[model samples]
Target: MSRIGKKPVELPKGVSASISGQTIEVKGPKGTRSFTAGDDVTITLEGTTVKVTPRGLSKRARQQWGMTRSMVSNLVVGVTEGFKKDLEIQGVGYRAAMAGNVLKLSLGYSHEVNFEVPKGVTVSSPKQTEIVVEGIDQQLVGQVAANIREWKRPEPYKGKGIRYKDEYIFRKEGKKK
Candidate 1:
């Protein structure tokens, strides 16, 4: 038995879910999201609770069942309450700014990099070094943040680069001669 699958997701107020065939759609105040059910996964709605169960106890099937359930639950909640990701730019002359639908980042590079913000997502910089990404889709928000951070990964020696707000980079000292 899967611990996560055993637990049913409680539907919050103002959020609604609809299941059709192998697709589940969730709509809320923020926006709407959808997820495709796996082959062996079964999704059911019992009153205000959503349940996911697998056809068999196979390793992969069981794993997918739990993950699908969690993803569906997250979709419902994310569309209702939304999701956010914070990133920090570290180093001299490293900063970020929003211009129209694009985000311009200066990560100690010779040329500035412009990232086009996707629809339904908002990128804001409270400070030159801090960036906040918000959207109803958790996966998209995370992917966008990761792509932006990839432009300038943290260097081990100086520990300077773009990184998530909660990410920690352990630094190592140079070898002594």
Candidate 2:
């Protein structure tokens, strides 16, 4: 038995869920989100709680049981509270700014790098050294942050570059001659 799957997802006040076959849709103050479970799992709405159960005794069904429950839970949270990712820029002259839908980054390069913000996700720079990615979808927000960090990953030697707010860098000792 799956521990997580055993627990039904509770619907908070002002949030609602609707089920259609294998798909479940959740709507809340933030936005609306939905998820479709695989054939191995069954989704049901019980009062204010949502439940997921495997359709068979197969290994694949067991594996999907927990995964499906988590996906449904994410849908509820996404519609209600949403998701956010914070990025911090390190190193001299490294900074970020939002010009409309474009993010301008200066990371010790000769030319400024322009990153076009995609739809559904909002990217902003509250401070020159900080970037905030916000959206209803957790995966999209994380992917966008990762893409921005890819431009200038933090180096172990000096720990300089873009990184998550709470991330810790394993600093390496520099050469001493």
Best by TM-score: 2
Q: By TM-score, how accurate is candidate 2? A: 0.98
Q: Clashing residue pairs in candidate 1, if any? A: none
The sequence of per-residue lDDT tens digits that candidate 2 reaches over residues 122-149 is 9999999999999999889989999999
lDDT of 1 by residue, 1-177 (tens): 888888899889988889998898888899889999888889998888889999887898889987988998899879888899999999988999999899999987789999999987899999999999999998889998899899999999888999999999999998899
lDDT of 1 at 155: 91
The alpha-carbon deviation from the true structure for residue 67 of candidate 1, after best TM-score superposition, in angstroms, is 1.1
Q: Model 1 scores what on Cα lDDT?
A: 0.90
* Model 2 lDDT at residue 85: 96
